[model samples]
Target chain A: MNTTGPDSPSRRELFRMIGSVAGGAAMYQAMSTLGFAAESTYRGPVDLSGAPRGASVLILGAGIAGMTAAYELRNAGYKVQVLEYNHRAGGRNWSLRGGDTYTELGGFTQQCEFDEGLYLNPGPWRIPYHHRGLLSYCKKLGVPLEAFVQVNYNAYLHSSKAFGGKPQRYREIKADYQGHVAELLAKATRQSALDAAVSREDREKLLESLRDWGALDADFRYGANLLASERRGYAKEPGGGLTARPLPSQPIGLTDVLDSGLWQGIPSGDRYDMQTALFQPVGGMGRIGEAFARELGPLIRYNAKVVDIRQDVHGVTATYEDLAAPGTKLQARADWCLCTIPLTVLAQIPMNVGAALHAAISAVPYSSAVKVGLQFKRRFWEEDEHIYGGISYTDLPITNIAYPNTGYHSAGKGVLLGAYIWGQNAMEFTAMPPALRVRKAVEYGSRIHPQYPAEFDNGIAVAWHRSPFTLGCYGMWSEAARAQHYDNLCQVDGRIALAGEHASFIGGWQEGAVTSALDAIGRLHQRAIARGKKA
Target chain B: MSIRHVTIRLALAVLGLSAAAAQADDASFMPIADLGQANGEQIYQHICQGCHMPGGEGASGAGFYPKLAGDPRLASWQYAAVTVLNGRNAMPPFGLPEDRISETRTVHLSDAQVAEVVNYIRSHFGNTYADTLTAADIAPLPHPR
Candidate 1:
């Protein structure tokens, strides 16, 4: 019952099942027929057929936004070049692994101590099933995708306030909440409490539906019985042969359940965006970036830190420094510009753009997020708790602990998202040293998984604000700021335009980056064609 | 600032570890037995160091923590002082809310410590600013609810 439905098959599982039986083309068609397909703003592959003759465009940052622009424009027969501060592609779409050293703005380098084949996606970790554009790119780039479990029945829902700080299985909370609601509603319906709203026949139907849906007994009570036990789980699971008999577990009272607030995490996976069939790259989220980089090949320039951006009626040019060498100025020029650098970092750079655009640039602020990746000696969550994959929600400062979705049931070391703090809690974590952050994460996570302190081998923590590349996590647009500047931020300013999560409605997501890039490039292409006609 | 530029900032992170090293030296002789009263890097290490880097580099991945190392934003000491003492957007107020401090234990900076850390960040971390914060400067600000 912790899951949204009875075995909501993942997109991958559904696709494979449909593909094997119905073929690839038939699977695509059956996907819709089966009513499991997600409808997105993306209408299949984008058509970029009419690029101007020999027009060139310069892109800033090799993040998903910039790379999406590059990947599409090059296919449309235009010359494209991308400038990135880091040596690799994918700005926020990054992953850290063994032997990888990260130097934050303040130059304290922490080399990732993760073991082989293990990695921590410090950036965009999960891809929603509805983010069609990103998913299409994953397919096109040959980046295999797998289901990212957002909820597991055995995973925990912990509240520090109630249950004496003990963690509760997600199934217990979800099943009990629905049971109480059903019992109350069924009782009300049977007693004519809904006489004004429903006909007697309809009330009888509603009562019957509630009993079945809530796993209620014939009398419509959700008590210690086999019917309720089927949903909430049994004390001793039914087995075959001699030990097949089952014992029903008592459901927690509604008052205790309400006060505990474990219900807060029960519906997390039920959200439209966080539903079943969620995905991640087969290896890590960073693989998508690396795949895009591979597709772009030599077109991307690494370690080019943009310091200034200038544009004239004819073309746009960016002045950058060779970050590898330090202080040496370099230049890259093109007829049009699509700057995907985060607003926080971009605001500090000088640019030749209109006042409106400048104001828009300075208007938005980026958010703060911190992630701690802790490597454990073994897959304890899977081995001991049977929580194969999914997240454990907690009221502790760590906020949430996410078990690895990949390498499930394997006899090997594993990495867990030990801490994912946001807002004020994130700031408190961000203020600490990396080692201390890791230590603190282990400390807090131990409450949910008592095996944490013993199993934790090494950990790496990334505080997004400390990154020199983007300077912040993602653009955060307040209602007041969006009202004044959201449109202005997206409008192509002269020959210069900006594209990134900051320039779109879906801020803080890669889908925003992908779609915003597509929109910006489409407009830029139109402008380029118009300029060609004039020329 | 958005939540991206959320937490403690290292005024001097990107430049080098010298700023953190210098602060470490200042706190080297302090009694480790009393972390609650420790000042300078000790306070920063125990409090702000989780989100901010040891050298004041705020953490980064998808979120942003403004670096304390010679950040151009630090030009306005009042802005810096207010951001830390009163807290900024997404950053919980570090002053007057004793419950908040009791909850986290890291942000429990005394009036004197708040002023001291601000002054330390401004003066160190590759910043050569002469103007520094004082307890008097912090004491005058109204405590946030």
Candidate 2:
């Protein structure tokens, strides 16, 4: 059975078996010996050396994907040119600050009224530590990073149907739920209910672990005691002077905890992408895009929208209309083309790709999302609620209310992500006028934070469906669609290859765009070298 | 819990309900909050009108939303039903089955609701098609995954 013959478990499977038997650490070591478990696919800067002299590439969209390709290709001696639909670089990597004006489709224009230094990132806001490709560029571009708080124990978890529509503190719910579950399990263990599952000696050890893990008392029970209150906070906190004694808070009943549905919010921070050590650029997420723009200055042509993309045996040519001077069509041609235009917009453009690629392009439908930024007169979340940073989840149409992570305790004014609505809720919000959307967000958010009505100075709402640049938000791939057309979408068609968040597995993320661009260009480079040799 | 605490919680709940009711009474909030009981036109305005536009004269800029006004595609009631039920290109399926709908989806459309909206779209937007699609016609059409 252990023989290395046909029908034997492969090395990966063997390691997985080791993982099930030993643990993750031992399996990781075994896998690492086999050149696996390297985490992110990005090793370092892509080596696009030995480029054929004078090999030029015409890139579409000045997004992260396009810029990453241009920056690397240029250094590798490829004459690269990038055409952006928007006047700015960063397609979705955008931040709206004070004095900035945004005009969505249907002619609704909003000028940001946020105070100086206050901003709203309408796009990719948080960068996880595991997204090495994007982090590497942030480092290379000299963009300073700051901690982006994903979860705060003091933040809220609200459901309009639960707890009589009253919002609950995250820590209280988390502690109570864990304590009750542990207490129940301990009861089972002590009653010999786990006699078949656990060894006689291990039962005591499991109970001991549960007591500490669940904040249970010495008798392996959870109640309104100091031990439980220490985990969820005291009703009367310990003080420095007289009247210093702390009062233990009563825990909600197990049935109430189960019925509240607040337990769903507990594991959000434990998710791989949402785990701690997340970073954001100091000023805004747009800093990374701006830095890339500065680095690839003259190479990028802003306000040039590609209307037609055609390719032949010779090379690829793109017919673009310069938005500044509307009707006149300008042409750019190169040996190869890298199109980073989003699938939503690209499906509309006349790109001469094969039937499979075209079918793949039309297959993925972009998801609807709406983000509303409300500028308040003061930092009431900090001053009043003590919610310094992190998001509050709600069951209302306005799905989340994210407090600002930066400038904690600062006076004057602050901007909060009043709402991050998605799915059906987003569609409804998108249908409304921008002002009405903002008003609704305020109304809904007020349920969680009663200070909203008095504090809200102004707001700007961006409904991705109404956004003219990329039409809808990010590509939403059904498992079936990805299985059928993902490879076809990524493969090079004639002289053109596609790359963006849509083209990568890590959709709706900057890391997807970065990694996808690197992957596309690496293949493109190989093809170019081969073509160069043939030439 | 203490009696006083229970009383305070009840008061807060009452306040929240009244505030929501008052907002619902306001004309501005009518279109968005009452999706569960909205009519065909109301559903269109609340959902489909964003990308397709208020008049159904689709706008084009970064991407093109094909004009539904006098669109030959909607002439076939089955075409309209399938598109709304299964989605086509950039359009999201408004009539996905409850189990198929993503977790983020808060609203679900029934077959009758889908028919109602489809009929509304076909008749309005400068489009006049007498053939009304029934909920029975929509129920049996295969949803391509």
Candidate 3:
């Protein structure tokens, strides 16, 4: 029964109206189905062609944002000097491996004991397809990339309270949930429960679509059948001769599936940022930073910690301590300064920026996060569980157990991301000694995989809060904080402008840093050219 | 909780009460307080190991997670307890024992848990502080800022 008249708008038209009524965000969300969202703003490389001769820019912090800026500015003929606090480049984009010892804020040194080739990318591990800016740089830098498996069908999804605390396979949960939801929707359509929502013509089409999508029977019921087994996996395999007969697997009922709450794990792979076609740099995520370091060479000054940042009408002078040398404070002068020091650290340092920018810097707080990389005696996850490279989530203190994306089907040892936790848990992990954290990770992990204790060899944990350079993980801006201070933070205050993940819309992402660097440089170049014209 | 959620909880509670399951493995849903095998270290391992990291050395990245091991900051137990209960800045207010975080039950820890975890951090990982704190020290603390 159709009740729509000529004036009645379609669903797309209705969402457009809602978008117009609500805002751009609402419109964006509404139009997401129409393929409107998720296009990277980076249009290849920045063309910084017209740079004034000998216009030097002092960049603080040799992080991705700073390096991106320096890499572009130097190519455009600007004299660039980057002061990095650490001996190595890539501030947060770091990878820890064997022989690397990290001494955090309070002087607790952690010596990484992972086998050769096995490393922990403590920051920025996965690169999304949509992050074209970083990806383009990767391609330009000749960094070899490989697929980062976002979802493994055979990975386990365990809840502390569900199914007698047993883990369910991703395929089993996804198949059962989809099959049940489809069956219910088909039933609703057949009973005309959705008469107002779907037209009669659409109803028949929807029913047909549900059957195909849900792997439902002709009667619209999902049960123990070959059709269901095709999506969920078969109990018995069909082969040649006597073993040719196949047995179908039984799907969990809708109630049980919903009650298990394992359904939460199903849609993570479907999210835009976490979708398929994700890539990780070959070897480790730090390869990109290392490549950037290789590209810049001596332009980057290592072991220089900026103690003070001051700017006059003429130029900006930053006083930095040579960590290797001690006692003496050296100064670097430039026409302009692009500081990428995290606000958490920058707030404490004396900088003569405007009150608004200073307030903006102090307003935004950084997140606390902890990650543990456990080296196992063998790749038991691959050998026993058949989970090649994906995340297995649990409610235990260790939030996720991410199997290594690389080294699939390789013999010998492997590393697993035992836990990647943030917020309160991070603070807690921040308090435990490094050895204790590894022991707890092993203990918590053994719940999901009983092989953890026996197979666990050595482990290292990184709590972002303890790092001397960066006291937290990343800038976590509240909506109110972003609304009030985001523009101020990003704005060029005199000869000083900030560029980092914190300066962009896409915070906590490497792309944000890259794009924000490009955007900051473009604006800074225009100002430089204007100043050059006046001179 | 909804009826379904209640049923799930009841099922979990039954599993929790099973003596056989408790005897079988530490993985079983035992109480957080019950699981502490003496020492502030074990308590810290059970509760604090998730985020503070396995090592009190603390994780490092874009920002600093001030190292608790050998940290001079724990000179005052009051400051430590307050930080745990009320949570500072980006840290969420937590310690509702057993992870039941709801509107009625907004906190994630008891006073004793806070003292134990805090003391654990102060004492372990090359730290030589001979200080101990109790639930009384933590009970009067304000909510995390």
List ranges where model 3 is wrong by over 4 Å.
A1-39, A533-535, B1-145
Cα lDDT for residue A296, model 1? 95
Clashes per model (N, Cα, C within 3 A) = 52, 0, 41
* lDDT tens per residue, model 1, A1-535: 1123333223333324434443332101001011122334577766777787888999998999999999999999888999998889998998998999998755657989998988988878888888889999999989999989988888888876679889999888888877877787778777877666666666667677778877888889988887888888998899999999999999998777766766666657765667788999987899999999999999999988888899988888999988789769999999999999888777768898888888888765455678899999999998888898888887666778888988878777999999876554565566655787788788778778889878889999998766778765776565556788888989999888889887776667788889889999999989988786422
A387 in model 2: Cα distance from truth in Å?
0.8
Order of candidate numbers by DockQ, starting with the best: 2, 3, 1
**What lDDT score goes with residue A172 in model 1?**
89
Residue runs of model 2 more than 4 Å from their true location after superposition? A1-39, A533-535, B1-17, B23-38, B103-108
Task: For each candidate in the order shown, give its overall lDDT on alpha carbons.
Answer: 0.74, 0.82, 0.76
Q: Tell me which residue pairs clash in candidate 2.
A: none
Q: Interface RMSDs of all predictions?
A: 8.7, 2.7, 6.7
**Docking category of candidate 1:** incorrect
lDDT of 2 by residue, A311-409 (tens): 989889999998899898999999899999988888889988899999999888777888999999999999998998898887677778888889999
Q: What is the TM-score of chain A alone in each candidate?
A: 0.92, 0.92, 0.92
Name the regions of candidate 1 deviating beyond 4 angstroms.
A1-40, A533-535, B1-145
Report the Cα lDDT for residue A290, model 2. Answer: 96
- Provide the fnat value for model 1, as a fraction from 0 to 1: 0.15
